[model samples]
Every structure is written in C-alpha cells, then in structure tokens.
Target chain A: MANSNTQADFRTRLQDWIPKLVLSPSLAAMLVFVYGFIAFTVYLSFTGSKMLPKYDWIGFENYARLWGLSHWWTAITNLGIFAFLYITICTIIGLGLAIFLDQKIRGEGMLRPIYLYPMALSFIVTGTAWKWIMDPGIGIENTMHLWGWESFEFGWIKDRDMAIYTVVIAAVWQTSGFVMAMFLAGLRGIDNEILKAAQIDGASNWNLYRRIVIPLLRPAFLSAFVILSHLAVKSYDLIIALTGGGPGRATELPATFMYSYTFTRNSMGIGAASAVIMLMTIAAIMTPYLYAELKEKA
Target chain B: MSVATQDTAVSTGRVTRTFIYLLLILFALFYLMPLFVMVANSLKPLPEITGGNMMALPQDWTIEPWLQAWSSAQIGVEPTGLKPYFLNSVLMVVPAVAISTVLGALNGYVLTKWRFRGDSILFGLMLFSCFIPFQIVLIPMAMILGKLGLAGSIPGLVLVHVVYGVGFTTLYYRNYYAAFPTELVRAAMIDGAGFFRIFWRIMLPVSGPITVVSVIWQFTNIWNDFLFGASFGGQSQPMTVALNNLVQSSTGVKEYNVHFAGAILAALPTLLVYIVAGRYFVRGLMAGSVKG
Candidate 1:
C-alpha cells in the first residue's frame, strides 16, 4: 500500500511538472529570441556600433545624427503621409463595402472572396502587378493611348511627386477587403433585437446606422485602426517591390530607412536606433490594448 | 430568423437596391482588376502588353512566360528561375508551420487546461511578440543565425519563422482550447492518460478547426514574407525575394509578361490556400485581430 501511494504521488508530481516543462521551450524561445534580441538591439543603439555591432557606449549619438539627416526627415514625412492616407482610405472603403454587403446582397459569397484574395497574395506580388499596371511605357498609360485616348497620362510609378499615392492604391486594394470582413463579423455579432427596436422607434436607415449600428461597431473600428496603423508603420515589402523607395527617395519610409542604414549603408547604430523607435511606437499603441485585453480575461 | 430578416431596419426601394448592387459590383471589380490584368497580361506575348490594350483579352495566348518564369528566367545572375526558391520556401514553411503549431498546441493546452500562476502574464508576453515590428530583431537575429551557422539557409529561415510564429499559433490554440470543455481532459487524466497521451487523444483530435486556422495563417505569412527572406535568406532566397529580383532587375530588357507570370507563381500557394479554405483564412485574420 505504501509503495503504491508513493508511486501515485510521483506520477501526479511528474504530470504537474509536465505542463510547465512543455511550456518552457516556447517561453524560453520568446524570452531569448523576442525579448533577448530586443535588448541586444536596444543596447546596440546606445553604442558606437557601425558596420558591425561594436560594444562602445556612445549615449544617443546615433540618435542625434539620425535626427539631423535630411534623408531621415524625408522618410518620416513620407511615413506620415502613407500611414494617414492608408488608414483613412482603407477604413472608409472597408466600412462602406461591409455595410453594403450586409444588406442581403446577391452573389455575396463570390464577391467576398474576390475582395479578399488580394490579402492572400504577397505584397511583392501585389507590388509587381501594380507596378506593371502603373508603368507608363507598357501599362495603363500605354493601354489608354492604344484605345484612342491619345492624351492619357498615368505615370505615378515613375513620378517622384505622386509615387506615394500609388503605394496607397495598392495597399488599399490588398487590405480593404480584410477590413470589410472584420466589420462584417462585427455586424453579424450585433444583437438583432436592438436593430428591430431602433426600427420600431422610427429611426431612418441613415439615422439607424449612424446612431445605432455604427456606434455599436466601436470594437471593429478600434481593431481596424490599430491593425491599419501598425501595418502602415511596418510597411516595407510593398514599398520595396512597388516603388523600391522611389523615383529618387520619394517613398523612403522608416522601415526602408532602417534596412538601408543597417544592412546596406553600414550604419548599424542608426538602424538600431530607428528600430528601437519603431518598437516603441508599436508598443505605445499595443501595450495598453494588450493589458486591457489580458486583464479583462483575468 | 425573423429578427435577422428585419435587422436591416429600413427596406430599400428598387432604385436604391439597384444602386447598392451596382456599387458593390464596382468595388468588387476594383478589387479584382489588378488580378485580371495580371492574368491577362501573363498570357499575352510581350508586344501585346506593351502596344495593346491591357484590359483586352489576349489575342494570342501563350504559356511561354509561365514556362520562363518557372524555369529559365534570370534571377540575380542565376538563370535558375523561381523553381529552386519556391522549393526553398516550401521546405521552410512546412517545418516552421508544423513545429510552431505543435508547440502552440502544447502551450495553449497548458495555459488553459493546466492552469498556473503568472500564466496570463506569460501569455500576454507571448501575444505582444506577435505585434512587434520585426525590424528590431533583424540585426540581432542575423548575428544569432551567423553564430549558429544557420545564416542564409532554409533552416535558418525556418527557425526564425517558428520562433516568431509561436506567438500567433499559441494565441489561436489558446482561444480555441479555452472554449473546449475541461471535463474531457479531466476524465482522460483520471483514466491515467499521460500528458502527451491526453493531448494527442483528447485535445488534438478535436483541435482540427483551430489547427486549420493556424496552418493557413502560418503558411500564408511565411510564404509571403519578404523582409526576413531578403535580410537573412542570403543564398537560399525564398519565392518572394526571387520574384522581387526577377521583377526589379534593371540590367535587362524588362519582360512585363514574364514578371506577371513570376508574380503569379509566387502568389499561387497562398492563393490556393485562400481559395480552398478561405473561411478559416478569414477566421484566422479575425482572430489575430480583436484578440479574445
């Protein structure tokens, strides 16, 4: 009897430890790869590291130099324009599509997939398609000329002044469908009785949506805003594939700026600083949201 | 059902309904036009694209561009085409997705069924990793890969993807298993089923939906990833990088048709996944956002 009890106790103890053991590998990986690597990058930013990561403390010198560079300013300015336009346009189109599709439309099944297939595509693929279509020599401009519109001119891909807008167009095309899906999900989850009640109260369609439905979609709006803003900030693949950072530095955002500095330009310190800034920007937006989410669950 | 029928609040007139359908169709066309252009141009010969209407169906359809993109097109000094890179991506994505999913299932199982102190904090940590701009880890990750002698290789890419992907996969499984009844897990445990046994038999058998969600999400993201493939991919560049090289190489006469074919080739796998399992794809997207 004593032997069996100890054996049972040992099995229970081992079983208890098994869960922790199983979780440790992933937790350790997150710590080392995610948190540890983040620390290393932050440390690299404070040092005089360039060309390679050197261990000499320099105390924000890279940041000061980073701030002074005209190229950096251009990247920041481009990012502001890109993020603002990208978010606003995607939201408007996405919400519009969602509202329309929610109205018991025919062929909704076929249309939703069409709207979302772009989200499945790599930004590179999207970029290549858009780049070709936007190319003046062989793309839309040429096609327009061929079809008897001799005065057509759509050279935004090659034009320095308007290249960024082309990026916005491709991005919107790729993601608006996804935003629509989120809103649709939100719309579906809404309590229908409330809508009926509001209808019985004689609210017009416009007033019903504006006063009841739209307000109820607050979570969806927050999710879209957060997701879109982060995507805009981390926008890299599309920029590289579509504009290659420009018709001459016209579309250089912070992501491209970080890569060029770190890998190509041998300014690892500056790149690290820029990367830290990017992390902080995302964290500022993400931390409180995460805290709220996790705390609510708790 | 009746409430759902009346949920639209105000029924619209025929004109408004027609207008709504028209607007939806227009937006759908807008969404699909680029894809249509790509498909159409990819089938046409070079001159048709350069000198003819892009919106027009190909007058002389040919698969030459597709063949060239798959096998003979020049990619960064190599005439090896996207075949090898596509293979590399497959190898990278498969292992990365598999390992991360398994790890995530275990982690999710533990976090939900086998509760522990500070588990929520740990989960919060894992979840936050999903949203970090990966730029911060690029330099250090490169250094780590170099140290491990895995730099620029397929394995290196796999390792990086799995490490980053665990957070997302974990989130999926956790949210899923949270809704699962603990009674089954408890009954299995009382019957002397070991950890792996219970998980394999009880948790995993019922984990199909979330698994689909996790796999589709991981496959798409890993296949479509460009920044890592470029930074760490060195010699074994993935399809996205290779496609970019094929399209962006400025030395040769630009073959727009070939470029479109290559882009389509790069897009096919994820596109296939989306078409086959788009419901789960949307579920993954929604789950990733608006966290449970």
Candidate 2:
C-alpha cells in the first residue's frame, strides 16, 4: 500500500512538470538565439573587431567613428526623410480610403483586397515592378513620349537628389493598404450609437469624422505609427532591390549601411554599432507602446 | 424643419457619394496599375516593351519570357532559371513553418493553460523579440551558422527563419488560446488525460482557425523573406535572390520581359494565397500589429 501511494504521487508530480518540459525548448532557443545573440552583438560593437570578430576591447571608438562618417550621416538623413514622408503619406491615404470605404459603398469586398494585394507581395517583387515602371528610357516617361507628350519626365529612380523619394513611393504603395485595413477595423469597432448621437446633435459628416471618428481611432493610429516607424528603420530588401542604395550612396539607409560595413567593408565593429543604434531607435518607439498594451491587459 | 433638413442632406449625400466612388475607383486603378503593367509586359515580346508604347496592349503576345524565366534565364552565371531556387524556397519554408508553428502552439498552450509564476514576464520577453531589428543579430547569426557548419545552406536559412519566426507564431497562438476556455483543459486533466493528451485531444481539435492564421502568416513571410535568403543563401539562393540576380545582372542586354515574368513567378504563390485566404490574412496582419 505504501509503495503504490508513493508511485501515484510521483506520477502526479511528473504530470505537473510536463507542461514546463514542453515549453523549455522554445524558452531555451529564445534565450540563446535572441537575448544571447543580442548580447554577443552588443559586445562586438565595443571591440576592435574588423574583417572578423576579435576580442580586444575598444570602448566607444566604433560608435565615434560611425557618427563621424559622411556615409553614415547620409544614411541617417535619408532615413529621416523616407520615414517622415512614408508615415505621413500612408496615414493620409490610408485614413482617407478607410473613411471613404466605410461609407456604405458598393463593391467594398472587391476593392479592399485590391488595396491590400501589394502587401502580400515580396518587397523584391515590388521593387522590380516599380524599377521597370520608373525607368526613364522605357517606362512612364517613354510611354508619355509615345502618347505625344514629348516633354514628360519621370526619372526619379536614377536621380541622386530624388532617389530616396522613390523609395518612399514604393514603400508607401506596399504598406498604405495595410494601414487602411487597420483603420477600417477600428472604424467598424466604434459604437454606432455614438455616431448616431453625434449625428442627431447636428454634427456634419466632416466634423463627425474630424472630432469623433479620428479621435476614437487613436489606438489604430498609434499602432500604425509604431509599426510603420519600425518597418522604416528596418527597410532593407526594398532599398536593395529598388535603388541598390545607389546613384552614389544617395539612398543608403542604416540597414544597408550595416550590411556593407560588416560583410563588404570589413568593419564589423562599426556595423555592429550601427545596428545597435538602430535597435535603440526602434526600442525608443516600441517600449512605451508595448508597456501600455501589456500593462493594460495584465 | 427636420424633413427639409433631411431632404437637403440626402441630395448633398448623393453628390458626395458620387465623388467618393470616383475617388475610390481612381485609387483602385492606381493600386492595380503595376500588376497590370507586369502581366501585360510579361506577355509581350522584348522589343515590344522596349520599342513600343508601354501602356499599349501587346501587338504580338508571347509566352517565351515565361518559359525562359522558368527554365533558362541566367541567375548569376547558371542558366538554370528560377526552378532550383524556387525548390530551395519550398524546402526551406515548409519545414521552417511546420517547426515554428508546432513549437508556438505548445508554447502558447503552456503560457495560457498551464499558467505559472512570472509567465507574463517571460511572455513579454518573447514578445519583444519579435520587434527587434534583425540587423543586430546578423553578424552573430552568421558566425553561429558558420560554427555549426550550416552556413550558406538551406538548412541554415531554415534555422534562422525558425528562430525569428517562433516569436510571431507564439504571439498568434497565445492570444488565440487565451480566449479558449481553460475549463475544457481542466476537465480533461480530471479525466486522466495527460498534458500532451489534453493538448492533442482537446486544444488542437478546436485550434483550426488560429492554425490557419498562423500557417498562412508563416507561409507568406518565409516565402517572401529576402534578407535571410540573401545573407545566408550562398549557393542555394531562394527565388527572390535569384530573381534579383537575374534582373540586376548587367552582362547582357536588360531583358525587361524576362524580368517581369520572373517577378510574376516569384509573386504567384503569395498572390494566390492573398486571393484565396485574404480574410484570414487581414486578421493575421491586424493581430500581429495590435497587441492583445
């Protein structure tokens, strides 16, 4: 009887541990892959690691050099422009389309997917299509010339000054539809009674949106801002495919900068430093939003 | 007075509605222009695209570009076309998706059903991993892959994707399973169902919707990933990298039609998924961005 009782207790204890055992693999992977790798990269940034990772500590030297490089400055400046325009234009176009579609329109199901199919595509595919369309010799400009508008010019893809804007245009085209969907979901979630009450109180359609609707979409807006900003910081494949960070380093963002430095230029320390700065930038934006979101749920 | 106001509002609304429809259609056309251009150009002969008007329909339609892009286009000195790389993508994506999704489902099951101390904090740590710029991990990941003898190979790429992708799949499953009633799990336990048994018999049986969302999300992302493919895919590059090579290769004359055909081929799988399961796709997108 005592032996049987002890066996039953052991089984029960084993059952209790099965869940944790099941979860341990993923936890271990995350610890080593995510946090451990991050720690390794952070450590590499402070060392004199070049061509390959070395152990000699060089303390802030890489970061100071990174900040001093004109290429790095250009990359940062281009990101500021790209992110600003991409965010603003996407918000405007997205909010407008969402509002317009929200009004009891016909053929919404058909139209919503059209706005969104681009998001399903690879950025490389997007870059390829846009690169062809934006080419000065054979694309829109050529087509316009064939249509007897001989003076029409759309060579932004090849232009040094305007190359970054081309990136913005492609990014916007790919992502704005997603932003619209988020807003539409938010718009749908708003209580109809609130809108009805506002209408009865003599709120015009314009005022109704500007006051009640837009304000209520604060969460969606915040989500869009955070998601887009982070995406902007991490923009790599798109720029590589579209511009190749080219026309003489005109369109380089930090992502491409980091890649070139680490792999091509033999400056792993500087590349790691640049990558760390990029992380800090994203964290600065994400930390607060995630905190509030997780805290509220908790 | 109310009737008069209602009449005026309806009349103005009709005009505004017309304007709104016009704008929506125009925007739709704008959004669709690139797809149209790609399809039309891919069907046209090379000379037609370069010499003739781009907006015009093909004077002589041809499937030569598609055949070439599929079978014989030069992607970095190999005239092997996109077939091998497409296969590489398939092999990489399937296992990566399967492993990540299974691990995520188990992780979600534990976090929600088998609640323990400091679970939320652990969950938070995993959640934040999803948002970090992957550049931070690139150098170390490359080193690690090299150390493990998996560098520049499909398995290496798969492992990389799985590591980054698990965070997302976990988020999806955890949020989904949270709303699932724990009472079912509890009852199963009382009935002598083991942890795996309850998960398999009870939890998974009802996990169809979230599974679809998770699978579709993982499929699209892994299929479309370029950074990892470019960084780690040396000899066995995926379709996107192959396509980039085919387009950017400057040795020969720019074959726009071939490039278009290749681009379309790269896009077809995800496009088909979007067309078929777009509702779930949107849900996944929303769920990913807006935290529960």
Best candidate according to TM-score: 1
lDDT of 1 at B271: 90
Interface RMSD of each: 1.3, 3.4
Top DockQ: which candidate number?
A: 1
DockQ of each: 0.77, 0.55
Model 2 chain A scores worst on lDDT over the 10 consecutive residues at: A188-197
Given candidate 2, what's the lDDT at residue B273? 83
Return the lDDT, model 2, position A289.
Answer: 84
lDDT of 1 at B191: 88
Root-mean-square deviation per candidate: 1.6, 2.9
lDDT of 1 by residue, A46-125 (tens): 99888999999999899999999999999999989989999999999999999988888889989999888899999999
Range of the 10 consecutive residues with the lowest summed lDDT in candidate 1 chain A = A289-298
